[model samples]
Target: MLQVGPDLVCIELKGVNAYLWTGPGGPTLIDTGMPGSWSQLVGDLAAHGVKPGDLKRIIVTHADFDHIGCLKALKAQSPALVACHTVEAVYVRGEKSKPANPSVLGYVVHPLMAGFQRRYDLGVWQLDELVVEGHVFPEGFTALHTPGHSPGHMSLLHKQAGILITGDALSNHKGKLSLPMVLATPNMGMAVESIRKLGGLTYETACFGHGPPIVGGASQAIAAFAQTL
Candidate 1:
């Protein structure tokens, strides 16, 4: 785990990572990992002398299964408010808008895994807050509307730490920095454009949902990754 700022603590899971930002108001848990990883997540927090049940809020970057599998589990234990973008908020609350299946490649793989979510009755969890651009959290953090991977996708920016919590808008998976999965995006153009905008931000850390974090030169790295689109 890396403490990027006074309030921000990042915990890296096997395939993805979640960020915890605590202040006078308690803690906000970023993305939850894939299904069946909740035990490990809770255990890790316990090991660090933090209780997952004390989380103040749970902020979802987007509504992918891998990122939200533990939403209900976490909510059941904590009184923390759950927040997501308007577009994604509906899905989290069990209202199906549009599944994010984007390409033939994704269609084949998505259904195989999505079936489990359906069978398990993993409806979208409820959201207490709708995050958008200009929404400011404690400690000088702002939400940036970085859409296209999923409509209303959001990234959190901490001006003080120069850190941007990029859900799946950008990735370091497979040992290289790149854009989100093309086959999983609703609009590749919009995703690329979003990346370009984030690329211009003055951030030193780019924390992602998958793989490792980018420690510095965020603006240039993001721009270069967007260029690949």
Candidate 2:
């Protein structure tokens, strides 16, 4: 676990990133890493003096397995309320087969990728809340509905801290900001447009779902990346 800011902590599990923020009531979790990562996640939280049941809320950016793999397990352990976009609530509730349609390449590769296809029985748990653009939560975080990677993908912004928890709307691999892989993103065009929207936001730090955090000048970096689209 890495503390990227005063109250922001990042837990990276096998390249997937989840975040912890010291909110007004308790620590708020951004995403739950891949399956089998529950122990590590709990341990990291403990390291920061946050024990089980101390987590007050869990905000899932999307319905991707990699992003919400540990949701059921985590929520079972803690009474944290789970919030996700309304569009993704169906998939989270197991009412839909998929969160979004996959691209041509994704269709060919998804079946072969066991990790992506793994089932976690998350359907048994119902989402406690549905978030949308402009929705505010504890710690002054606001949900930004930036879809394309997934129809309900969201990027969170802590306006006061200038921090953006970019779910899968944007990726920062090796400090490089770019769109997520096209194969996994069924609507690449919409994803690009989302990036443009993010570029307009004012933020200094960026926390990605798949890479290390960008600590400074994050808005400028995203703006520069948007120009290439």
Candidate 3:
């Protein structure tokens, strides 16, 4: 785990990353990592002095299996309120078998990706809160709706820290920023628009769901990438 900001630790699970924020209210988790990652997540939190019971809430950026794979297990242990965008709530609750918006390639590759799908044990779960664009959490992070990768994908912005937690809306591969794969990202046009939208934000650090974080000059990097779109 890496402490990206004051009381904000980035927990890496395999290649995916989850974040832990400690505040006066306790700890809040952002994304839950892939399946079979629950034990390590709990251990990491404990190492940071946050007990499982100390978790106050779990914020899901989207309904991707990798993002929410351990959600059910974590919630069973912590009972933290699971919050996500209204559009994504359906997938979290198992009302939909897959993300509402999947790239055209996803439709073609989904069948062949059964082994990958089997890694996640998705099921129905109650959402404690519905988040929307501009909604601010108690921890001071504001929700920014950046769909395309998924119909209700969201990125979080912590203005004071100049940090943006990009939940698959953007990714960092080998220190370079890029969009999620088109095969997995159903709506490329909207995804491109979302990338342009992110460029409008002010941030110096960006934490991606995949790859290492860019701790400085994040906004400039985003703008430069936007021009290529």
Candidate 4:
């Protein structure tokens, strides 16, 4: 678990923590873990002083298998409104399953994923609200559309906390590379551009999906990461 600011705690659940952030009225959870993880997640939340029913919003950065895999389960347990970018709404709602790249390599492996996808019963989610530029979230947070990992992918920016919850835009794990996450989005160019965009922002800490969060010197870390490209 990592703390970006006084009230914002990012609990990394080894698999994925249903991130909970408290506000004036209640707490907002981001990225529910895989299904059947409710009991453990609840235990963690309870330990942190948060209850399942206190969740206000379930903000999914993107509709990747690991990111939003537990959305349906969490929504059923809690009344939190699920939200995602407009481009990803269909996938989040299960109306459209994840599409594979048409590349030769992609075709070779797409068939292997059929069973896994079926087992998860992955579905698309509805966009309760669209997150665009200048959108303020509860407790002084803002949403930034840092796509490329997935079309319409987003990252939450906490201006007051100087923290950037980068979905998969910039990974600090397995040799930091300014590129699209493996098996995620296919476009590498878009991924690089997205990282550059994030580098321009003023932030002190960066939280990622896979690697450990970068606590300080965000600009330097990003610039150095760009050089590795």
TM-score of decoy 4: 0.87
How would you encode candidate 4's per-residue C-alpha lDDT over 1-229 as one tens digit per residue? Answer: 6665566666665555445677543488777666566676777778778776777888888776677666776776777766777776766766655555456776666555534555687674445776675677765668788767677788878877787878777666654544554455656667777888788788888777666667788867886676666
For model 4, where is the 10-residue window of minimal lDDT? Answer: 175-184
lDDT of 2 by residue, 29-132 (tens): 99888878888888888898987588889899987777887888887788888898888787666666453336566777655442354456655356888988
Q: Is candidate 1 or candidate 2 better by lDDT?
A: 2
After the best TM-score superposition of candidate 1, give how far the Cα of residue 218 lies from its true spot, in angstroms.
1.9
| C-alpha lDDT of all candidate models, in order | 0.77, 0.83, 0.83, 0.69
Using Cα atoms with residue i matched to residue i, what is each candidate's TM-score against the true structure?
A: 0.89, 0.93, 0.93, 0.87
- Candidate 2 lDDT: 0.83
- Candidate closer to the true structure by TM-score (higher is better), 2 or 4: 2
The deviation in Å at residue 59 for candidate 3 is: 0.2
Query: 154 in model 1: Cα distance from truth in Å?
Result: 1.2
Backbone clashes for every candidate come to 2, 0, 3, 7
Count of clashing pairs, candidate 3: 3
**Shift in Å, residue 228, candidate 2:** 0.7
